[model samples]
Target: MNIILKNIKHISVNEGITINKLEQIIGASKGVLSRAIAKNTDIQTKWLVNIVKNYPQYSCEWLIKNEGEMIKPTGEIFLTKENIEETAINYKDLAESRKETIDSMKKEIMYLEEKIENLKKQNELL
Candidate 1:
């Protein structure tokens, strides 16, 4: 089998799902991948991208080029108490920072939009 089909099979087995379920996860038709495998042609880029997006735990390099492991190294989760505490703190800090940034951006956008509206009115007056 081609690397593409092999990767798909690997993912299905790892995820404990069938080929049909894999198709569902990748948002593709049931027979599309099978046909591609039978023809031994390259799978389309869009399909590959969709699959990667849905299953970010899988290494894209491995999926397309067979260059790395199926599951990304960073995809592993550490559930130690220290790790959990650190993650919780980091998440809270990130959320607060993001909220502040988003609020500032909204204000800046509103200011720019008002300035644009004023410029439009001035042009109309001219």
Candidate 2:
């Protein structure tokens, strides 16, 4: 696994937060967030700063290199109303995105299923 993915996964697991939710809270798209989390790529400092600033619960060391715990030792996760409101708006946007992605994926799956069924039919005919 890429270091970014590993870090992202570790943070998500440790902090009890999803990548999508985090991305939403930070006002980044899912694709951008996914790319940023990849170890092979260099994540811009500004974006990383934005994420940490928005959610202090995330540890900089952990988010950067997957070395430390996602949460700080003190465990004082900031949950201010402003942060909540920002996160809430992102969640609202994510809700629609979630539905869209699911529908698209479902369509792709159906297409693959049809292709498999046709292949099976061809095999039976052979």
Predicted structure with the largest TM-score when compared to the true one? 2
* C-alpha RMSD of candidate 2: 5.2
Please give the lDDT score for candidate 2: 0.70
List per-prediction Cα lDDT, in the order shown.
Answer: 0.72, 0.70
- Model 1, residue 119: distance off in Å is 93
List clash counts for every candidate, in order: 0, 1
| Model 1 bad stretches (over 4 Å) | 75-126
Q: Mark the regions of model 2 whose C-alpha exceeds 4 Å error after superposition.
A: 1-45, 64-67
Pairs that collide, model 1? none
Summarize candidate 1's per-residue lDDT along 8-53 as a digit string, tens digits: 7787666655566556556788877767766777777778887766
